[model samples]
Structure formats: C-alpha cells, structure tokens
Target chain A: MTHLKTKHRLLADKAMLWIVCLFATLTAVPLFAILGEVLLRGYDQLSWSFFTETTPTAYKAMKAIEAGEPIPGGIANGIIGTMIMLGMAAIVAVPTGILCGAFLAENPKNRFSQTVSYLTDLLQGTPSVIIGIVTYMWVVVPMKGYSAIAGSVALFVMMLPLIIRSTEETLKILPASLKEAGLALGGNRARVMLKVQLPAAFGGIFTGVLLAISRVIGETAPLMFTALGCSFIRFSIDKPISAVPLLIWEFFNDPNLQELIWGASLFLLLFVLTLNLTAKYLAKKWNQ
Target chain B: MESVKPILEFNKTCVSYTKQTMAVKYVSAAIDRNTITAIMGPSGCGKSTLLRAANLMHELYPNIRVDGEILLNGENILSMEPVDVRRRIGMVFQRPAPFPTMSITDNVLAGYALNGIRLSKAEREETVERCLKSVALWDEVKDVLNKKGTFLSGGQQQRLCIARALAMKPDVLLMDEPTSALDPIATAHIEKLMQELQKEVTILIVTHNMGQAMRISSKSMFMYLGELVEYGDTATMFSTPKDERTKAYLTGRMG
Candidate 1:
C-alpha cells in the first residue's frame, strides 16, 4: 500500500512540474513575440541618417511617402533630449536618494525614518500621470514654459524612491558583524558609511540607479506635460525637448509619420532591456 | 612597591537586553596587562556579552543597556566617547570578516583609513608588514596584497582579521570566540596566534572550548546564566573549581 501511494505521489509531482513549466513558457511567449514583431517592422527603417537626423515634419514625411521612399531624418533630437534629461535627473537624485536610504537603514526604529520610509513606498506607487501633472504645475508653470528641466524634475521624483529602497535593503541585508567590526575599530558612523557600508552596497545601489533610469526612460505622459514637444534638435535645457517615447507618441498621431513608430519603440525597448540585463550582470559579478 | 594596576577592570558590569532581563549581572573582574584571559561558558552564558561590553559594542543597539563601570587603565570607559574608547581597544568576531571591498593590505590598514588618518606609503607598507607578520600571515599573503581579503582561505582570512586589529596597536583586544567557526586545524592556528599576540597586547577572549581556555589562557573566567561563576588562575580553575557550577561545566556534567 505504501509503495502504491509513493508511486501515485511521484506521478502527481511530475504533473505539477509540467504544469509549472507550461505556465512559465506561456509567460515568456509575449516578451519574445513583442521583440520579434518590433524587430521585423523596425529593422528596415534603421540607418545612419535615421540616427543622425532630426525627426522629419509631417509634410516632408507625406512627400517621402508619395515618392515611395523611406521617411527622411532620424530621432537624434529625442535621443539627445532623453540623454540630457536623464543626466540631470541622475545628478540630483542619486546622492539625495543614497543619503536618505542610509538614514532609513541606520535608524529603522526611529519614528521620523519610519514615516519617510512609508512615504517613499507611497511615492513609488504613485501614478506616472499624476506625477506629470504635478510637475507641470510646479515646474512648467513656474518656468513660464515647458522645459527639459521640468521633464528631468519628474524623472528625478520617479527615480528617488527606487534608489533609496535598494540602498536601504542592501545595507540592511549585510551582516551586522561588518558594521560592528568597523565601529570596533573606532571609525565614526560617517566614515564607516563612506568607506565601508556604501562601498559594500555599491553594486545594489548602482543596479538600482540603472533600473531607475530604464524605468523612467520610456515615460511619455510626464514628458508630455513638462518637455511638451520640439521638432528640432535643441541643446538648452530651459526650452522644450523631445524624448524617444514622445517621438513614438508623435508618430502615432501623424498618419504619414506612423511608419517611424516601431523604430522609436524598438529603440526604447532595446535600451531598457540592455540596462536591465547589465544591471543584473553587474549585481551578480559584484556579489561574488 | 605597589602592584601595577590592571589593564582592564570590570566593576560589577551589567548588560541587559531589556529593562527586565539582564544578560550579564554584576560581573566584576580585573585583567593584568599583556596577559591572555579566556572567558569560558556554554551558549547564552553572557561570556560574549561581557566581552562586548568592554568595547562598548552595546552602544549600537538602543534598547540593550550596559550599566556599571568598565574601566581601561583605571579610567571609566562607560562615559568616554565610544569612538575614543574603541580607538584604544580592538576586537575580532567569531566569523572572519576582513572588509569585503578591501584588498589584503588595505584590510590591514582599514582602521587607519576608517579613522581618516592618512599614512605615507612607506609607513603604510611597514604597518601592514609588521601586523601581518605578528599574525603569521605575512608569508602567505605578501604576494597577493592587492587581492581582496575575501579570497583567502577561512583560517587565512581569520588571521587577516587579526592582523587588521593588530595594526591599530590597541591597548586591549577583545575576541568573541574568534576560533569557534573554524576547523580543528584553523582553531589551533588561531589558538597558537593568540599565545604569541598576548606578549604585545592584553587579550580577553570568549570561548566555549574548555581545552582552548586551558591551552592558551593564563587566567580563566567561567560564567553561568549571566553571572561570573569562577575567576582565578587557569590551572587552579581547571584542577579545582571553587564554584559548583564551574566544576559542573568543566566536567561536562552541566551546560
């Protein structure tokens, strides 16, 4: 009887394993499907000029379509704008996030830190659309026009919670003995944090920063309200800008420019995928 | 002539994790300078707690209270700044922890770096060499000074931790079962290292291994249930413990 029961149980376990594998494959299918569709549709549009030139006007795109030629001009303006805004956001957010994370991790029981930690969670859960409107009111309105600075302020708000949470969590998981040993050496809290804890947590914090940038890179609603839209390549941050997602949205709106949509989407998707993969790889290498 | 004052003195030191329960209760003892003293006990016997109190490790936790005076060189350490007191004292934990981010040489010089005390290149080299030599690790790790200390073998890593502590040239070294996590050979290596280290710095070590206490320590303390049960010369305590609890523990009849 026992032998029979063991055989039945093993069969059940095998069935469960197969079911889980099927579900896992089902979950992965859409990711590959999206990659395949985007690659096929966008590969022809990619070229040297496609990356170098700014977006073509709707009239130019219509003229190109009538001539039976590929749309002339690329997403240089959007790419440059995204880079500038990301740089600005990371510059302000990284240090502030790390310090706040240190405070939260070091004082887990303090009432103020607990409140701040809770607020960070709430901020992370907030909708991107709401954040965009808030940025418009606080930044675009104040500056008297939509600007790259306003766009970055929205990205900064979005990135802050992620960096803080990662830094805090990484520091928290480290063996308490590490901190004790540092302190036992007579190192003050600040020096120990700077020299020991932060260095130890660098992998996780850096991964979080990369993940944060990837997270905000595809944001269109926030950029819509803050950066508005610019047709030409612009360098000055106080004026309007165009990001990759914004270009995709713009392409979606114009019938003649619709062929460029997949290219922008593919570029954004590939960039985010690479960032996520690099973050994972660096995290693994650093841990060892 | 009057006898020299003890290097470290615990005057009725008490450590309580809470307001109601005391982990260490009125444990009074004095340690002679440049001698090895072993604190032996079973698990949860407050031996480790007593050792941690000497270094003010209790300060990190908010609720855990350490009362009574811990004096170093006849000055009360409980009131002194934790950083100031810790500078004069060093510690090694059970598991070997050579800063993961640091190289072997940098691990040795971590105390200086953490204190923001810059050393000339020559002085840094000398201190690393001297400290590693004292821990018997200079020969093994000299070539891989740039490699991260985490790459070393367990015993070698433990020795590196010891070297890191020795680099500070502290007055007292508190070790909380530094060899407990090692294999027999590694444990023996640390035991032998401690014997040599005592000549330069006063050593207070917590161990559950009775043979280890008998092997290296000149003085022995046996604690039971948060109280110091016995304190005397090692030979005397091993041969004839005055307290019943101490004898029971040594004879393996009680924990």
Candidate 2:
C-alpha cells in the first residue's frame, strides 16, 4: 500500500508540472505571435522618409510601393503635432497632479484636499471617450474647429489622474523615518517636502509621468474629435491637426491605401513601443 | 574643569501623547556644557521623549503636548523658533537614518544643502573632512566618499549620521539609542567616538543599555514610568543608587 501511495504522489507532481508549463506557454504565445506579425507586415513600410514626408492626399495613395522609392508623403507634421500636444499635456498635468497628490497624502483631512482627491478618483473612473466628447463640445466646437489645443486638453485630463494616483501611492510608501530625519535636522515642512520627500519619491513620480505619456500618445478616440485628420502638414494649434492614429483611421478605411495605412500603423506602434521601453528602463533605474 | 553655563535645562517638563497617557511627567534636569550626560531607562520609560523634547523635536507630533521650559544656552528653546532651535541642537535617531539618496560626503554635508546655506567648494570639503574625522569615520570611508551612505554597516551608518549632525557645528548633540542597532564591535566604536566627541560638544544620549550608560556617561539620570527616579554622577548612581526604584533597576530586579 505504501509503495502504491508513493507512485501516486509522483504522478500527481508530474501532472502539476505539466499544468504549470501549459499555463506559461499560454501566457507567452500570443504576445510573441502578435509581435512577429507586426514586424513581418510592417517591415516593408519602414524607411527614413516615412518619418520625414508629409501625409499623402487621396491622389497619392494610387502609387505602388517600390524599393528605395521615397514614400510620397511623410509623418513629419503628425510627429511634430504629437510632440507639441503631449508636451503641453505634460506641462499642464505634472505640477497640478504632484501638488494635489502631495496635499492629499500629507493632509488628508483638509476639506479642499479631500474634495480634490474625490474629484481625482471620479476623473480616473470616468471613460476617456466621454472626456474626448466633452472636450469636443466644450473646447473644439466652441472654438468653431478641431485644433491641437483641444486635443491637448483631452490628453491633459487623461494624464492627470494617472500621475496623481502614482505620486500619492509613492509618497504614502515612503518611510516615515525620512520625514522625521529631515524635521529633526531643522527642516521646516515645505523644506522637508521639497528637499527630502520629493527627492526620495523622484524616481516613482518620473515613472508615473512617463506612463501617463505612453497612455496618451496612441490615444485615438480623444484626438479623433479634437484634432481632425489632415492630409497636409500643419503645425498651428489653432488649425486642424494630423497625427498617426487619425491618419491610420482614415487610410485603413480606403482599401487602396493599404500600404499607407500599414506604414502609419507601424509608426504609431514603434512610437508607443519606444515610450513603453523608456518607462520600463526608468522604473527599473529609479527603483534601485 | 572650568565652569561653563549649562547648555540645556529642562524645567518641570511634562509630555503627553494622549489625554489618557503621559509619556514624560514633571521632569527637570540640567545638562552641563562639554560633558556627556546619559539618560538611562527601560523600554517605554520616556528617556527618548525627554531627549526629543530638549530640542523641540517632539513638536512634530500633533498629538503631543509639552509644558515647561527647555532652555538651550540660556534661552527657552520651547518658545524659540523650532527651526532655529534645532539648528543649534542637532539630533541623531535610534536607527541609522542616513539619507539613502545621498553619498557619504553629501550625507555629512546634508544640513547645509537642506538649509540652502551655500559654502565655497573649499569650505564644503573642509567641513566634510572635519566632521568625518570627528566621528572617527574618516579613515574607513575616505576612499568611498562618493559611495551611497546606506551602503555602510549599521555602526558605520550611525557614525555617518553623527558626522552629518556635527557638520552643522551645533552647540548640543542629542543621541537617542545611537548604538542600539549595531553589533558589539560597532557599539564599541560609537561609544569611543561619543566619549571623544563630548570634549567639543555637549552630549546628551538616551540608552537602554545599562553597561553603555555606565561606561561612557559622566552624569547619568535614571527614569521609570515617566518620572525621574535618580540623577547623580554615573559612579554614584550605579554603585550607590539612593532611590529604591533606581537600585531595583540597576540590580535587574525591576525594569
């Protein structure tokens, strides 16, 4: 009977190991498959001119893809517009988020701070699509046209809650001993937050900002309403703007514009991928 | 020894963290300038609280209420600006709480940076060297001045914290269990450093280690249950404690 029990136990262990291996494979296979498909399908469209040339009009989509042929239009205008909108979003979101986070974490009982935290939670839970629609109605429609400025407002709203939540959590995790040490060293409250608390939490806050940027860079729904797609290059925030997502949307709908759609999709994918990698690198470096 | 004014005087100081609990009650003591005064007690006996109150460090807690005057160099530190008061009386915590983000050299010079006091490059270097030497850490850490302060051993980190405190050149140094976190060898190093440091700065240390209190302290005060049980020369207190509680504590009959 004892020998029979030992054999059964060994079989059970083997079964468990098989299940674990199966789970690991299930988790990894799809990611690799998607990455492989993207690389294979997107390789032909990758070129220096893809980044430098403007988006081609409907007439230019008739041209065939040939090796070493400059893609008639580039993504330069979209790239510049994305940079400007994301930059403005960062400028608007970072300070407001950090200050709100600090206040909520440090003085949770203050009425204003409590209200701010409640609003942040509400904003975080609200749908991004709804935010985009609201921006269209309130900002873009009021101004009588789609513009980069309206898109930036939408991105800023999306970025704020992410930064605030991450910064607050980081501050909360900081050891109380650090604050006590600073105060014991004759540092006043503001001085302690500025010099000690902020520095100690710097890595986490930076990662938060990067993650927010990555979240908004490929956002389509929000920019769709705020910055309507344009075939020609335009840098003015007051005018309709072009971005990789909107370009992909417009190009993908036209069956003849397959190569252009794939090229724009590749650019957008690469941009998002680079941002994610940067976020990962920064998080690792700061965590240490 | 030449006579000097007392560096710190706590007059009928009472501290309570809660309405129902008193941490320290009616404690009065005078600490001599340029001498090591050790406050020894069992756990939760309020020795650390008294040390914190001396420098107004207790003010950080909203729930703590402190009554009575804490005179530092003939001024009531309790009434003075807490920032200014703390500038003259630097504190070292029970644990080695060196700023982890700072290098060993920067940790020593942290006070100046946090206070926005700019010193010339030469002056800054000199201060770092002097403070490190004062804490007997110069030789061990000279080669790794740029290394993170948290990389040091527990005792070494504590010494680095002491050096950081001394860099401000404060008139008084308050230590709360400065060696408790360390091993015996590190404890010995810190005890030795404290003995030498007392000659230049007024030292007030709180320790639960009775042997440490007896070895390095010149004047010792015994506290129990938030009251001063005895205050006398270290020799007299350990050899011939007057109070029954003091004798009981020294003989290990009571905590």
Candidate 3:
C-alpha cells in the first residue's frame, strides 16, 4: 500500500511540474512574438532618412505605401519632440519629487505629511487621461494653443507619484544604524539627509527616476490632449509637437503610413525596454 | 581623585518613549574626566538608555521625553541644542556602523563634515591619520584608505567607527556594548584601545559582560529594570557587593 501511494504522489508531482512549465511558456510567447516581429519588420526602416526626415500628412503617401514603395519620410521630428517634452518634464519633476520624498521620510509623524501622503496616493490612482485633460485646460487653454510644454505638464503629473513613492521607499528601507551613525557624529538633520541617507539611497532613487521616465515615455493619451501631434518638426516649447506614440496613434489607420507606425512602435518599445532593464540592473548594483 | 571634575552627570534623569512606559527611571550618576566608567546590566535594564541620555541622543525618536538634568562640563545639556550637544559628547553603538556609503578616510572625517567645519585637504588628511592611528587601525587600513568602509572586517569597521567619533574631538565618548557583536579577540582589542582612549577623553561604556566591566573600568554602575541598583569602584563592587540584589545578580540567581 505504501509503495502504491508513493507512486501516485510522484505522478502528481510530475504532472504539476509539466503543467507549470507549459503555462510559463504560454505567458512568454506573446512577449517574444512581439519583439521578434518588431525587430525583423522595423530593421529596414531605421535608415538615415528614416531618422532625419518629417512625415508627409498627404493621403497619397498611403498610396505610395500601398504600392510597396519606401515611405518618403522618417520620425526625427517625433524623436526630437519626445526628447524636448521629457527633458522639460524631468527638469521640473526630479528636484520637486525628491525633495517631497525627503520631507515625507523625515517628518513621518507630522500631520501635514499624513495629508500630503494621502493626496499623493490619490493623485497616483487618478486616470492618465484626466491628468492630460487637466493640463490641457490649465496650460493649453491659457496659452490659447497646444504646446509641448502643456504636454510635459501632463507627463510630469503622471510621473510625480512614482518618483515620490520610490524615493520615499528607498530612504525608508535603509538601515536605521546609518542615520544614527551620522547623528552621533554631530550631523544636523539636513546633513544626515544629504550626506548619509541620500547617498545610501542613491541607487534606489535613480532607479525610481528611470522607472518613472519609462512609464511616461510611451503614454499617448496625455500627449493627444496637450501637444496634439504636429506633422512638422518644431522644437519650441510653446509649439505643438510630435512623439513616437502619438505618431503611431495618428497614422496607424493610414494604409500608406502603416510602415512608419510599425517602425515608430518598435522604437518606442525598445526605448522603454532599455530604460527599464537599465533601471533594474542599477537597482541591483547600487542597492547591494 | 576628589580634585578631578566630573565630565558628565545625570541628575535624577528620566527617559521614556511614551508617557506611559519609562525606559530609564530616576537615575543619577557622575562620570569623572579622563576615566573609563562601565555600566553593566542585563538586557532591557536601561543601561544603554541612560548612556544615550547624556548626549541627548534619545531625541532620535519623536514623542520620547527626557526630564531632569544632563550636565556636561557643569552645563546642563538638556537645555542646549541637541545637535551641538551631540557634537560635544559622541556615541558608539553595539554594532559596527561605518557609513556604507563612505570610504575609510572619509568615514574618519565625517564628524568634521557633519559639523559643517571645512578643513583644508592637508589638515583633513592629518586629522584622519591621527584619529586612525589613535584607534590602531592606521596601518591596517592606510593602503586602502579610499576603499569603502564596509570592505573592512567587523573589528576593523568598529575601530573605524571609534576613529570617526574621536575625530570630532568630543569631550566624552559613550559606548553601548560596542563589542557585543564582536569575537572575543576583537572585544579584547577594543578593551585595550579603550584603556588608551581614556587618557584623552572621559569614557562611559554600557556592557552586559560583567568581566569586561571589571576588566577595564575604574568605576562600575549596575542597573536593573529602569533603576540603578549599585554604583561604586569596580573592585569593591565585584569583590564585595553590598546590596543583596547585586549579590544575587552576580551569582546569576536572576537577571
């Protein structure tokens, strides 16, 4: 009886192992398929003109694409526009987010911190489209036109919660002994935060920044309401701009421009993928 | 001995994290200058709490109130700014706490930087050498001064912490079972270092090792459950404990 029971257990365990492996492969298939398709199909369009030229808004470009001719233009304008908006948003968000995080970490017991933490949590749960619409009303309406600056405000709003939460968590997770050591050495509160806690949490904080950037980099809903996607190249913050995701959204329906959309999708995916991987790697190396 | 001034004095000090439960009860003791005083007790007996009260290090927690007087050089430290008070009386905790983010040389100079005192590169180097040598860690770490402080062994890291505290030029040093996490050999190394350190600054050490207290301290104080049970010269306390409770404790009847 014991030998027969043991045999039955072994069979069950083997069945469970194989079932898990099958599910694992199932979960991985779509990710690999998407990557494979993008890399193979997108490689041909990543040429010099593909990068340095602007998109043609004309419907005839779709005819050229349908005729199996090379698309006439590239997404340099989208790439540059994305850079401008992200850079602007980073300039405003990085310092503000870190400082806010520090305040939360340092004065954990204060009533104001409690209120701020609750507000930050609420803001994080709020939808991305709502933020984009709010930014459009606040900045675009005031300026009487769509602009990259308004678009960046939307991105900044989306990024705040991630940055603040990550920075706070990074600081909170450090050993109390580190801060106590600084205090014992006669460091003031600010000095302890800057020289000890901040440095100790550097890797976590930088990783958080990268994660925040990645989260917002490919968001098209916010940009649609603010920057509103222009065809021409424009660097001015006050002018409407193009971005990879926005371009993909606008041209995905056009048969002639479908290739550009695929190419842009690939760029967007790889860009965010590289950032997330780098952030994860740095978090491991530094937090060690 | 009578002519020597007390470097630190606790006048009926009381410390508590919350209003309801006290960590350190009404306890008073005087620690003389240029001498090593050991506070020995069982776990959670308030020895560490009493030692931390001297420098207002207890302020690290919010809502914990400290009432009564803590005097340093005849001035009440309780009334002074906590930061400035800490600068005058440094502390070393049970475990080696060399800043993980700093290098050996930088760790030693951290005190000066914490105080916002800018020293020239030459002066900073000189101070680092002097402090590390004082703790006898200079030769072992001189070649790797730029390496991270965490790269050192447990004993070396603890010694580096001592050097870091000493660099601040504090008038008194408080150690709370600093060798509890160390091996016997490392503990002996620190005990010997404390003997030399006492010649320059008043030392107050909290330890659970009764032999360690008897070995290095000229004066010893025994505390139990938020109160001081006995205080006297180490030899008299160990050889002829007057209090019945002290005798019972020494004999390991109860903690």
**Top model by TM-score, which number?**
1
Q: A1-288, model 3: which lDDT tens digit per residue? A: 999999999999999999999999999999999999988888887888877999876575866767878878888889999999999998899889999999998888899998999999999999889998999899999999999999999999988988899999999988888888899888998998999899989999999999999999998998999999888899899989998889988778666677787778788999999999999999889956
Candidate 2 lDDT over residue span B178-238, tens digit each = 8888999999999999989988899999998899998999999999999988888999999
In angstroms, the error of model 3 at A23 is 4.9
Per-residue CA lDDT of model 1 for A1-288, tens digit only, reads 999999999999999999999999999999999999999999888888888899999999999999999899999999999999999999999999999999999999999999999999999999998999999999999899999999999999999999999999989988898999999999999999888899988999999899999999999999999998798899999999989999999999999999999888888899999999999999999788
Provide the TM-score for each candidate, comma-separated. Answer: 0.98, 0.88, 0.95
| Candidate 3 chain A: 10-residue stretch with minimal lDDT | A56-65
Docking class of 3: high
Candidate 2 pairs with clashing backbones: A53-A74, A54-A74
**Best candidate according to DockQ:** 1
The positional error of residue B130 in candidate 3, measured at the CA in angstroms, is 1.0
lDDT per residue for candidate 1 within B1-255, as digits (tens), equals 223679999999999998889999999999999899999988999999899989999889889898898999889999999999999999999999889999999999999999999999999999999999999999998899999999999999999999998899999999999988899998898899999989899999999898999999999999999999889999999998999898888999987
Better DockQ candidate (1, 2): 1
Looking at candidate 3 chain B, the ten consecutive residues that score lowest on lDDT are B1-10
Clashing pairs in 3: A62-A256
